[model samples]
Target: MECDASTIVSGFVEKVVSRYAESIDRDNVAPPEFFRDAAGHGVFGLPIPREYGGWGLPFSDFMDALRLIARESPSIAHIIFVHSMSAYFVEKFGSEEAREEILPGAARGERILALAFTEPGAGSDLASIETRAEKRGDTYVLEGEKLFTTNALYADTFIVLARTGPLEARHKALTLFALDKAEGVEVGEPLDLMGFRGTGLARVLLKGVEVPSSRVLGRENEGFKPAVVGLGVGRLPFASIALGIAEGALEEAVRWALERKSFGRPIFENQAVSFPLAEVAAEVEAVKALIRRTAELHDKGENILLHASIAKFLAARLAVKATRIAVQVMGGRGLLTASKVSRLYRDAKAAEIAEGTNEVQLMIIARDLAKRVR
Candidate 1:
């Protein structure tokens, strides 16, 4: 079946894909003009309600759009994903005031939102976070540090998770706030990373930052549920991004293979290079199927946590392998800085680390299996 938003997304890809890559690798930033074009094209609001200036498309369409963007620049796609995902959470769980304050700006792409869940001490163990949000009469005084927050420096808003009660409460005491980086919030310098260099990942410090009570998202002490649900929704898009990266790598490898000659014949004629390319193609297709199936489960309102984890884990592993093999197929040309395959190889590593690490996804799946057994 034809997808609803694919045609619009194709236009976006055609216009902005090459620009995204140039800005990401050379400028180390997403160009403002590129974001302006995306906003004008109704991309930022794909999942939000039409009343809120969004397209009101389903998650599947959203996933497709993200994949298309990711094919050109994963970092730009990462920025878009975080903002759209934050909008989704606010629409579902935020109070009326919170929604009204954030959704419109998000829809307009005027507000960029980032998630602040990871801490220096709590990498994947979210319950161990020490960021505290002490309640005052009509506000919360937040004091803590968040690490590895994507778009932190550039974001206008943050969905910050902070400890609200006793240590034993852990997950139960966790609360989420829709915080603006106005007064007490401080963002550190951006991280110079191995890949996804364009994403403004930074350390955020909230020093007695006062957030209005209305900024609380969802019910007090009930943040974990929406957080986990948001992750389930996010995984499919991340998998799609991985698929795009692999496809890009494969395309580059094929082009190089056809042009590069060895033994008086094109490299494509060699069994060794051709075999790996074929295998990579098959792996990408298989992962695409897995992503589609998981997306279907989500659309059907079925429990998708297990399937989401499976898709994420499989896609991440395959992306790394496929990109590596593509690089190998292109030989020395692939290792050159100017080669697109070289960029894909780096982007693939970032894909494995983002959303959730491959190791983390596997553990989540294993835990679900254990619960089923019990």
Candidate 2:
């Protein structure tokens, strides 16, 4: 049976997230206690195994929880997505020793995980990563820099992708290491982002950071696991977050249209205001259905690449559209920096770029379609 996460979601939102969300965005930083409080509510452990000190809920439930959190603060939800996705990688592919060492702390949110995948030269083209990990004895010395690493400021560990073989090997040359933030690991100052502001997004400099071969996730030289497995599983949950943003924006728009009167009657009564919101509402519902279906396919071990891409693509676009409409409906109030609708608009724009860009998603979908004819 699928566990419903609503109760936990409600409690966490009311007690821990609701009040501080605006401040977190305004300050462009979430307090340390916010994460701890989320941990206390089992927010971090929802999808981890019970044996690893997690609730072990289905992937769908975890996504549901994330969606609820996103409705209030997409920044916090983005943090959770990065942290949880990294944990998911470890739990699904890490060695027993690595799992035992990392999962428990991660499940408790005591040890935050940052995914160090993108580099200055390699964003969508992950196979072009230049980070090199030279094997020596039983350890590998890593030297590279990762950019836009979410959760970098608070990460206790980094799941880094580096080249382990010849450049000609391409995807086969890659390897993933669970490297601790020890000596030689430097996190740069967080970038001032237009949206998803409080996620601690920063660059990481790895200079001769050494770790045991045992720290390698999956087999050596197969770090493309993220592109093949990690992203397949990840896109749906990301779609769910976009869904939440759209839902939240749509709700705010409806409420504003109903309350804000223009020329006597409520603005909602006018077709001009209602039409756009209604269209956005329909698209939001469609995205929700797509996300749910993709999540179900994920849990069943089905091929979710195309479905996940389509869902993410549509949902992200919906988030942007919905937030734009919400802002339009609210007029000047929505433009204010302090307005929640304004904040959602900024975040929705970012959603289109994160979790794989809209263009990337279209490429995936198009390639999948092309494969059918051959």
Candidate 3:
């Protein structure tokens, strides 16, 4: 990492993040100023290359900042995820014209981007996607809807994954496009979600939306894994997010346990309360270890699909378990809307469903394992 972590945390996290996390979470919208300041500080491009006006941290180091941001405001962390992922995708797969147009401006916080991949009928089954972009002369016209498109409300650019060939073509027919919500595009209302609400989660409608032909990402009709897998997004990004949520919840539960007194003694002294918290803390450490290992493998340029799945799979479940424990430890305070644990619990539940469901991750892992077995 080029910039110091302590300084960013002091200036950004302590000064801005700590102050705004609650209000943003409550309102379900991160203010534009937050993005401006964060981008100015290079928080938006931690993993992006320096040539693109980013800090250019390795993936491992980027995880540290993501974890810190998540600990304070998971909703904002979600925003960071979308921003960094979109930037990285463009830097890796976008055409020179598209990259030059978007990345530099993105680092300046003047541009925001999101990936529109998941659909109402297509979550784990990316092949079933119905969104399509038909080519006509110099422009590609898009007509479809994207569900759970985070950051759509405020994003200036969107990298849409659409089907460009017959449905029977499956992965071979998939294509990636870089489009702007400049015209013929409609953004739905922000979802009142259980968690990650403030990150502008919403549905996007495209009715004959036109994008210049120069914006096509990667090669046409060959969008299987080449377009995204090389970036190591699902493994490190989602796993680190899970780690941050778990750590945040654990911190809250620990603080409450040690501070509140019961029966003229600290409630934390009770083995019943303390043991579970300890277990969650241990689980957090284990998840961190796994995430770090996967990150190291990623930096080494190893094929980390297996490691990523392992990390993403384990960390996701860990978030759910740790948050539930945190809420239980806080007792009645956890149930109150005013309590941070309440929000953490909700966020943790959302983690399991994001990226891919736990069952889907397991299938990937199990398939690989079975193939390698003697």
For all predictions, the C-alpha RMSD in Å is 2.1, 1.5, 1.6
Cα lDDT tens digits, model 1, 68-134, are: 7877777777887888887887888888888988898888888888888899998767888899999
| Span of ten consecutive residues with least summed lDDT in model 3 | 226-235
Give the clashing residue pairs of candidate 3, or none. Answer: 28-198
Compose the digit string of candidate 2's lDDT tens values, residues 77-106.
888888889998898779999999999999
* Span of 10 residues, lowest total lDDT, candidate 1: 1-10
Clashing pairs in 2: none
Find the number of clashing residue pairs for candidate 1: 0
| Clashing residue pairs in candidate 1 (N, C-alpha, C atoms within 3 angstroms) | none
Backbone clashes under 3 angstroms, per model: 0, 0, 1
Best of the two (2, 3) by TM-score? 2
> Lowest summed-lDDT stretch of 10 residues in model 2?
1-10
In order, the Cα lDDT scores of the candidates are: 0.82, 0.87, 0.82
lDDT of 3 by residue, 1-374 (tens): 45775576557787777877888889888887777767766677677678888777777877877788888888887888887888877887888999999998777677888888888998888878889889899888898999998899889898888888998888788888888878566899999898886888889998889988788888888666754483335557777888898999999998999998999977899999999889888988988988888788878878788778788888889888988988888889988986888887788788888777778779988998899994
Model 2 alpha-carbon miss at residue 137, Å? 0.3
